[model samples]
Target chain A: MNTTSILDIKNLHAGVAGKAILKGISLTIGPGEVHAVMGPNGSGKSTLAAVLAGREGYDITAGEARYLGQDLLELDPEERARAGLFLAFQYPVEIPGVNSTYFLKSALNEQRKHRGLPELDAIEFLKLVKEKIKLLDLNEDLLKRAVNVGFSGGEKKRNEIFQMAVLDPTLAVLDETDSGLDIDALRVVSEGVNKLKAPGKAQLVITHYQRLLNHIVPDYVHVLMEGRIVRSGGKELALELEERGYDWISRELQLAA
Target chain B: MSAVAPATVRPVEPATEVDPWVQPFARLESGALFPQQPAWVFPLRKAGLARFAELGLPTLAHEDWRFTNVAPLKGLPFAPTLAAPTQRLADGELDARPFARLPGDRLVFLDGHFVPGLSRVGTASGGGVVTSLAAAFRTHAGLLERHLTRYAHGSANPFTALNDAYFTDGALIHVPAGRVIEHPVQLVFVASGEEEGRAQHVRNLILAEAGSQFTVVEHYLGRGTATTVTNAVTEVVAADQVVMDHLKFQDESRAAYHFAAVHADLGRASQVNLHSFALGSRVSRHNIHTALNGEGLECVLNGLYLTDGDQLADHYMVVEHAQPHTASHEYFNGILEGRSRGVFHGRILVRPGAQKTDAKQTNKNLLLSDDATVNTKPQLEIYADDVKCTHGATVGQLPPEQIFYLRSRGLPLETARRMLIHAFAGEIIDRVRCAPLREELDRLVWDRLEQDTQIQVGPHA
Candidate 1:
């Protein structure tokens, strides 16, 4: 167990149903470190996120995940969330009839209650939410509507960041948050993520393209292919991958094997 | 418990034999029941009797009631309350009901007979009439004679016909032309648990003249676990350019049987909204029928039912488009848990030459357990060439993705499930234009969902 690290995965092998996706994957991230996991389609990038968030249907056949010196795999998804672990879903769910503001307030209060903190009343929640939405440039009217319902693609992505800003989790995992955003929405979303950075917080960003890293840069870049992190380097590795696609890494792995 | 032979101990009769209700019907008919009524009511009652005799009790062979089995009702010995009961009710008991605090004219009825002592007949602001049907028989006889048993008396439902044949007393509301009733007239029907197996027939008549507007709420309540039977029928007559809202809220005892029907006659350019909320009774069914008899009229039928335990809630709707440029929209949603069942049958008929007609129907059900059952059918018959009609029905458990999303946000599994279920019901509750009623329903429904232990939060599939 790495007590100082925010997340530690040791030989983690998991899959959905019976097929293995993340095979023998190992990673560790300490506080204040921003790590980006770059991978192509079908490279098990989302499996890792789903496993960490305790999504059902994924079986962790072997190995373990340790978060803040505790077994992350043992905790329920809500327990993990209350323990300050967050996963911004790749596709935001549209929950009809549930007001966005009310949903966020309930989530914030549940986490607060778990931490032995007093729950915020409606007025206090609205005040806090008003300040958080401005950070992501979200429309106030969206708060009145159902959660993520009738939202455009860019609006949904921005809403995810806005929720992350309000929850203020210790470990935030961004899963394909920049997939369907326009250039302006990309900048706004990335800027919002950058503003939420703190010395005590750690972020694990998963993306296919390096365009998002241009705004919210990461300190560490890891290349994931065939369910394993084959290469690791500094931030410049993203630029290298952008210049030269993921084919070279696969060829290099094949040559080495 | 009485000297009469218990149904369980009696021998089973043949299916082709006459219904046992014939004896009770003959006894009640021989006795003097409201002899002071006008001469015209006699013929209407006779016609209703003949219709009920012709229709009889609906069996599994009936196509309209194929999913809902009413055979359980035949085995029970329920005595109809032909006259007023001497049962005394206190004021505090009335205050315990939902929407009891709403400031409006309330007519209280016990076992289907109006109780003047427990009621408050306030004067309408715009020359409207809000009184008991018995009282209106003397005050507004013309309106009652013209509208009472005129719209719903011809319904094919045996329960509606039974109500017409034996209905003792109910509410009679008349909104005159251009008159708007500010406060909704509330008719509270309380079922006292003093006598078990008691039957009550309720009849309500609502007449809104041209340019008039009003809202009426019919609330059915029960005390304890009395196995009562309530057969209620409401007839609404909307004149040209009239706007009206009718809400039927039934929360009876878990051991009771409730059967009700609401028939509306919409006029030219009129807008009528009917809302039904069913939450109790072991076996309950409500029928809503609306006819767009004039051009450019709009009608909205919205309903929500929550069933648990061994309860069954059924809603049957029929919207008839008889004129061009008419519109009708229906939305019905249900939440079932335990071994409860829910049935929805929506039929939209566009008559010949009724061009430019628009009709939409949607029925969605959420089952909380594997044992919970839902049967939904949407039948659309369009004869006009240039009409637009659409309908869709869905039945399933809570979406796992949505539940996971909420749980990922730190909400517990139970809270997530409850929130989703409440939101499913809120879609229909929010359609209520009355703000106070909507707010009350929101709170009441949340409380009901929270207190229900049968709504298990874990995965049932």
Candidate 2:
């Protein structure tokens, strides 16, 4: 039972185009932990995930985010990915002309290469992907197509989870993974996320509602309002927030200020 | 350059005086002799020679040759090579050319001389005859005389005129009516080494009568030569209810030059898909013209050009829909890098009686470097009513967001960019319906990027 910290974010202050959005955000996740981040609209939930993923056009005013004790801010986006940081995009881009299978294989090989491991052959890759394909309940035809091209809304989200199951990233930021999913897709995606839970790995679930937290059953739930975390409690905190909405947190934050 | 730039290009006038290289070619023509000829051949040669002498070289002032400046060729001593060069190559040395083998017939011409030892045309390919143009002229004189100079009147272009006057040898394929040749007739024209500053005049003609179907793959490969030029002319007569797929692949040396013209006459209900792949040469230009004489004809002109370094590739097409219910589609894509330049001029003309004509033209270019240039114009001139004609051109680079998306997946910067570029070229390569040829071309395009592109690829820490 090795319970070590997989990710540590300290006083992260980030924004876009010179306006600050994240104000002194501090969080930590231990191994095998699923921490839910519930915030209202424009609460900077996506901005936090984007900054952690090293997205461009995001000016980090001041922050110290670390993955496995390595400086995450110093690495480029691809470097960050190679170092085991995965971000499930809120709006996945449609990359034309690139085959899905080819792109995934390239990505997996890149990560393996960075770890000083031998590359996987085609047969070996196909065997692994065929098993992972079923975990997300995705159709085999999607893998043969271009990445995210002509895919339905639910399919793109499922694809994000499918990639997560394949790459086995040390830490993953699911930014609004439940935004556009129906109940069935939500259950499938949650099951896929739950299957990947293991020691030496963690997840930061970012969402605007508590619907996704119900299926995954996070160990802790934190309410973020106006660039700061004003409340954090056990899984029941999600139920309380869902019942009372984010108005309680905003009122409490006003009293504290 | 931006796409919104005004379309105002001042014409550049070339020296109207006689070009010095034309005199040497004329001198070589005087000493050369044909294998066999009828009385009409003499008049045809005289007309071609007289046109070359009068036209000299095309000037920039001419509307057709505006973007492509052949001024560099004026200085080269491109004397026609009458005698074959001594540089012999093995049969297996396809010179890095794709689709080196076919099931039916293959005609190999080295330095404009038919090389029987290197070719493999079995007797199994029966109804259709594939032989050297020289041999065809000596044997099937009537067949050669009927279609040789009837379509491509050399007076239109000087290069076509020169090719008609000095064509020592080439391939001639004739597929009989109602018969379909299962395999393609492959023609490989090699400019042997040490033919530096020399030129090769090659001619190819395909005569497919009614109900005939076949494919012709013509490859012009240049290697080991210091500087060479390939001036070729191909005339195709596609009779009624025929299907002919013609593909020309030009992979000359980076220091070489290539000038080719394809003049085709399609019959009623005939379909001709012409594909031109330009991958090499310092300066290359292709003139493609098709006359849809019969009603209900389909003429497809598709081209893909990948150029880098100081290379220049140009494609000019004019499709005339003379009869009603004719359709023509012209699509050309180019990828330019370094200081290379690409030119595409496509025109679709609908005659007075050519009602119900459906024509579409599109030219798209991808520039990898800031210095690379592309000038594309898709024009339509219609005089008939009840016709549909549309054309557009786009010159741009790979989208940066696509690169970011790929990079977010752990692909390195270089790999992501090279993949995108290959994908850009793949859009055109995939349209090739031939399965093996398409696969082989995909491999070649990837290999070119791996071996030629400046992007560095290796392990990243």
Best model number under DockQ: 1
Alpha-carbon RMSD, candidate 2: 4.0
Over B1-461, each residue of candidate 1 has an lDDT whose tens digit, in order, gives: 01212112111233233255544566555546776677787667767766676777877666677678888776777678887887778768778679988877889999999988778876554567788888788888887876788788568887787787778899988788998877778999988756777889989988888998878899998885768899999989999999877989999999889999999999999999999999989989999999899999999999999988999999989899999999999999998888999998888889998999999989999987789999888887789999999888888888999999999999998888878998999999998877777888888878888777433754452
Chain B TM-score of every predicted model: 0.93, 0.91
lDDT of 2 by residue, A1-257 (tens): 12257788889998888898999888888988999998999889998998888777888888788878887888888998888889888888887678899999999999999999888889999999999999999998998888899999999999999998888898989999998899999999999999998888899999998889889999988888878887899999999998998888788777998
Error of 1 at B55 (Å): 1.1
lDDT of each: 0.87, 0.83
Docking class of 1: high
**Candidate 1 off by > 4 Å:** B1-20, B24-31, B123-125, B458-461
User: lDDT, candidate 2, residue A77?
Assistant: 82
Q: B273 in model 1: Cα distance from truth in Å?
A: 1.6
Q: A21 in model 1: Cα distance from truth in Å?
A: 0.4
The residue pairs found clashing in candidate 2 are none
The lowest-lDDT stretch of 10 consecutive residues in candidate 2 chain A is A1-10
On lDDT, the candidate that comes out on top is 1
Residue A55 of model 1: what lDDT?
Answer: 95
